[model samples]
Target: MTLTLDGEKIDRNRFTGAKVENATFHNCDFSGADLTGSEFIGCTFYDRDSRLGCRFSRAQLKDASFKSCDLSMTDFRNVSALSIEIRECRAQGADFRGASFMNMITSRSWFCSAYITKSNLSYANFSKVVLEKCELWENRWNGAQILGANFSGSDLSGGEFASFDWRAADFTHCDLTNSELGELDVRNVDLQGVKLDSEQASQLMERLGILVIG
Candidate 1:
């Protein structure tokens, strides 16, 4: 029986190491709150404009709208936020290892140089995000909307980008070694300074109706 504090602004509260269950925070703000090492199992935090550095390390924010928040440099390692919408936030250098947030909507955010390895982000809409110099290895991006996103200088090795609508995406100077691009349509995507393998280039060409005949 968790308290339904929906659409409320909770500031400077100590939620550290507390297990909150079935709490839905719609259009709420957690400004200056310390949620470090807390277990928010089956809780939702939506519309949080965190400007005072709220911490969220090893927290379980599963199956919720964790949206509209600025979680810059927040410890997001080992968090289970399945189908979460982490939109319009600044999460630079955040570690998302072993985090499962599939079909997420992460648009208009700045995730520059974030360490995101072994994560599941299938069918996600990552539009207009600054992902420059990011270490995105071994992540799932199947059927994702990577439109208008920037992957410049990002090491996207061993990542999957199959069947993604990548029109208007920028992959400048990105490393794509052993990346799964089986059905990636790159017709309107930008490849000005991209660095991919020969087979990967051929796959992109094939998707653009260009047959490679020896």
Candidate 2:
């Protein structure tokens, strides 16, 4: 029996550097709250009964981390998430639309950062999100909605991309070695500066009907 703390209103609160576990925050408003350096483990933010998810929209999540958490169908829209880490978490169908991971220095000058490794991101909405130069390796991206998303210079190595569309997002300058490039057509998607292992390259060549000799 998993005991859960439900319907807790922690919005606009400063829970910086705090650690929470096994808590259910269904429909809870965490908007504009400071959760920097906090860690959440085995926590659930989605309510299956009402199909509602907790709101982390516009939250300060810099360096905030989550591990083994069920964040399915959660709202993370427009959050400032620089250096946010999510490891081994079940974030299926979570919304990350409009989330900013970049630190702007001046006009046309900025750098992005985030460590989202080993998480399940299947069917998650990242449409039009900019995640350039971030650490996003080893995640399961099956059926993720990444239309018009920019992932340039990001490390996406060792990821599982079954049923993923490479043409829907930008993968230029990305390290995609040892990843399953499902349906990734080399002729359709731009692969400039994209790194792939020899085996993956050969597999892609086979898809284009090109006979890879040796």
Candidate 3:
């Protein structure tokens, strides 16, 4: 059940349980289509235009560019996406668990309620993005620029965030247990109502030049 969409324009179509594995879509357009429950394992989407509910589980999107489209609720679990550009898209409720994103630019996108566990986001720029209530546990975010982003009520436990820029970001009521914070800068970022241990809070405050008197 494999479908190959090469240089095709498929607009407003509903494709469910469609197997699109090992296919190559060159300059294809799938705007406003409902591709829920679709599997796209080992597929290549070069300069494709896909939008809204395009689910892809265990897919390998290597060298793909989903630039400037609405790709909400798109499942990317266990997907290997190298050099992908998902900039300025609505990617809410998209599951990216166990995915590796290398040199990817997913800036200014909405990732509300998205599950992104065990993903590699090193050197990726999620600047000015809205990530409300998203699950990002055990992920690596080293050298990533996440300024002015909203991460309210998100679970970021056991993640690696060494030397990242998180200025003006909100972490209200978020969980950050057992996460790596080696030399992280928390200046101008709100830390109220955040779930952290005393040692973690003290270490974070000490980095912010706050002297604790007993």
Candidate 4:
């Protein structure tokens, strides 16, 4: 029985295909909103006594969808969010610095899309976001800042990523299967079409000591 909506503005609202449930939205703004194919369930948008969340700056959010949302410290700066679908969201320290999940064709060619599965996104910032070829599966990303982020050809299979650095984010052809990759320093992060398994490729070849016996 939530339905709070504190500082409501609902900027340029449309809420396309709306289906909202268990709403809260404390510092609500939803700037330039469209929310295409919207479906937010169990929403909160983080208030927690004036901690203030909801903003969605420049939002259009194509194919927007969320589930079990809290969206802690949410802002989602400069959003365009193609095919967005954040599942099991918590979104800790959310900022999404200049988000744009691109779809452009010309002018340096673009191809990005969002899915953001099993989200927690601890310390989320995503500075310089691009989100190329995205799906972003099984998310937690313990300390996600992602400076100059690209996430090239993303899948990010079964992610957790404790204290994530990974050379300040590019993850070329990413799919890090069954991921927990804490300090993934595979010769300074450029595992072209990366898709590690088999005990994380024998723990990154025993940290380059190459002791993957048998």
lDDT by residue for model 3 over 70-117, one digit each (tens)?
344455655555434454344444555555543334765433435556
On TM-score, the stronger of 3 and 4 is: 3
1 or 4, greater by lDDT: 4
Residue-wise C-alpha lDDT for candidate 4, range 133-198, written one tens digit per residue: 788899898988988888887998999999888898788878889988888878877889788889
lDDT of 3: 0.57
lDDT of 2 by residue, 1-214 (tens): 5546567668565467888878677777788889988889888888989887788999999989988888888899999999998998888999999899989999899999999999999999999999999999999999999999999999999999988989989999999999988889899999999999999999999988987888
Model 1 spans > 4 angstroms off:
1-111, 185-187, 202-214
- Any residue pairs clashing in model 3, and if so which? none
Q: What is the model-wide C-alpha lDDT for candidate 2?
A: 0.89
For model 2, the superposed segments whose C-alpha errors exceed 4 Å read 1-3
Q: lDDT for every model? A: 0.55, 0.89, 0.57, 0.86
lDDT of 1 by residue, 1-214 (tens): 6666644656544565566666655545454344444445445443345322233434455433333333343444445544333433334334444443433347654334245555455654456555676667666777655666777887778877767665656777888778986655565556666677888877778877898776
lDDT of 4: 0.86
Alpha-carbon deviation at 8 in model 2, angstroms: 3.2
Segments of candidate 3 deviating more than 4 angstroms? 1-33, 41-111, 205-214
Q: What is the TM-score of each candidate against the true structure?
A: 0.49, 0.93, 0.53, 0.36
Candidate 4 lDDT at 155 equals 90
Tell me how far candidate 3 lies from the true structure as C-alpha RMSD in angstroms. 11.0
